[model samples]
Target: MFPNLELVKMVADIENPTLFSHDLKSADILFLDLIVSGGNINTLADFIADIPILIITSAISRWQYPEFIKNREHFALQKPISLQMFQSCIEKAIQP
Candidate 1:
């Protein structure tokens, strides 16, 4: 399993992102999660023009967040995420 620090390192090497919105623009891969209630999901989605979004959440279904879940470029990363899963999500989202 990849450590959180390693994940951060991987992201760091790719490009420096100021906000979640900027990250989406610079990177083909984007991981969006709600550390709280997923309320920001819609806001983030709105900022993402065409980038794919990998969402991590404890919510069982997409209905939990209506605005963000309707996107085809979106993927769900259920909580208790594994390293392989996270990496795969990243790859899939970023792959052109």
Candidate 2:
């Protein structure tokens, strides 16, 4: 779908999340799964401060991450994501 985009997948080792870090400074966007990161969203959010992020979480209603909520560049998508919603979020995130 995103023909011009380059996607890189990284599996975070929950036991050692920091072990897989590799020059993410140049990445245009970040797709993160909150549950899989061992609830270390803040740390990862801070690391990619300037980049736009699409966060996936099962507990959408209970989410209280003010930092992400307040940022226009950050988007949260609930579990069982739909293609239309995903596409909309991607478009919004990439908008200037």
TM-score of each: 0.53, 0.67
At residue 70, give the lDDT of candidate 1. Answer: 63
The runs of at least 3 residues in candidate 1 whose Cα sits more than 4 Å from the true structure, single-residue gaps closed, are: 1-20, 35-39, 53-60, 88-96
Clashes found in each candidate (C-alpha, N, C closer than 3 A): 0, 0
Error of 2 at 65 (Å): 3.0
- Residue lDDT tens for model 1, 7-73: 2212322222334445456554445554444243345555555764455544456676555556465
How many angstroms is residue 39 displaced in model 1 relative to the true structure, after the best TM-score fit? 7.0
Q: Pick the candidate with the highest TM-score.
A: 2
Question: With candidate 1 superimposed using the best TM-score fit, by how many Å does residue 95's alpha carbon deviate from the native?
Answer: 5.9
Worst 10 residues of 2 by lDDT: 13-22
What CA RMSD would you report for each candidate?
Answer: 6.6, 3.0
Model 2 C-alpha RMSD vs. true structure (Å) is: 3.0
